[model samples]
Target: MQFQFHPLTRKEATELISWRYDRPLDIYNIKVDTDSLQNTVDFFVDPKNSYFAISSDLHEFTAFCCIGADAQVPGGDYSLDALDIGLGIRPELTSQGLGSPIAIATIDYAKQSFSPQRLRVTIAAFNFRALKVWQNLAFLPVQRFRKQNGGNEYLVFIRNT
Candidate 1:
């Protein structure tokens, strides 16, 4: 599918707040208090977050992406000069072979937008589906670590841009 990316909007952020994923992958769901929709909306709409909404058909919201610090997970070694990438494919769209294209597009976007020397991604260890996609893009394993809050294990991957 052809892809178009644009700055995230309040309406899109509001809709994303309702996207729920199944177990294992459910960890990607937004975790803010549902009572304060404004808080979550503010996150995606904020200029510093670098959030972008993705779509092919004008009427469909395919995915959302973020670059930079907001894309980095806590407790990861972010000392490198790589722009991080964060993406979420609509729950129903997962495992349907869409990740690679979206990811390639995201990397191209990151290059033209950030021009970082490298790129980085931190993913949940159990998310082999995502890991495989990143690996296919040549994002190599850097390290495996738990968050300072001490939750599930996560692996960090990096690749030269």
Candidate 2:
């Protein structure tokens, strides 16, 4: 199938409002907060952040990610010049070989726009799919931290830009 990326708009924001968190994957993998999603959409819709929705055949919003400049590293790791980007695919799309290319596109966009020295990805420790995807894309483990949600902590992956 064909794929393309579109800027998330107000219309898309409204559509996300209807996104049901009932997918089996959501119960175990995704951390969806309605308010946060809405706020992110509102912020990215601004001209400043290069956030976009990935689509198949330019028809469906399969995934979304953001590109930004000089994101502060959470643990004062000055070596990390960029922020770990956020990405999400509709739960139905999981384990379907869609993440790598979409992530590569976002990384390429970030490299072109921000020229960061490094790129990072933070994944929930229990989310094996995400860990594998990021690892496949050459993101190496840099750190880990305890999360209030319990279980294992989040793993941070870093890739030099």
Candidate 3:
């Protein structure tokens, strides 16, 4: 499957907020309360943030990706020079063997567009699937820490660009 990346729009952001996942993965769900709707939209639409929507040849929204400072979850020491990134597939698509292609596409897109020195990604410690995928891609574990509110443990992985 070929993936096309495009700047995320306000409409896509709102659509993304509606995506819900099963247990474990549910932590990724984005919620925009009424009061924060505007701010949420602002953060997603701003070009400086590198928020993007990924689609397939059919033009259906398969996933979303974000890179740089915005992708950093709180509590991780991001002082290292690496392009941080995050990727989420639509709920129904999980565990369907699409991870490698989607991830490869996202990595390629990030490398071509950002020209970063290296790439880093943070994953919830419980998400073994993602950890395995990144490891298979040669990303090694670099650090681990709790979320900002002292939530679940998170692992940071890095791979050279």
Best by lDDT: 3
Q: Which is the winner by lDDT between candidate 1 and candidate 3? A: 3
The order by descending lDDT is 3, 1, 2
Candidate 3 residue spans exceeding 4 A from truth: none
Tens-digit per-residue lDDT, 32-128, candidate 2: 4866876755765775776677777634887777655422224434355655576777666667787787777778866775677888877777778
TM-score, each model?
Answer: 0.94, 0.73, 0.95
Model 1 residue 65 distance off true place after TM-score fit, in angstroms: 0.6
Q: Candidate 2 — what's its lDDT?
A: 0.67
- lDDT for model 3, please: 0.91
Residue 63 error for model 3, in Å?
A: 0.3
Tell me each candidate's RMSD, in Å, in order. 1.4, 4.1, 1.2
lDDT (Cα, tens digit) per residue for candidate 1, span 63-158: 889998998878888887788999888888778888998998899988998889999999999999889999999999999999779878889999
Over 64-90, each residue of candidate 3 has an lDDT whose tens digit, in order, gives 999888889899999999999999998
The most accurate candidate by TM-score is 3
- By summed lDDT, which 10 consecutive residues of candidate 1 come out lowest? 55-64
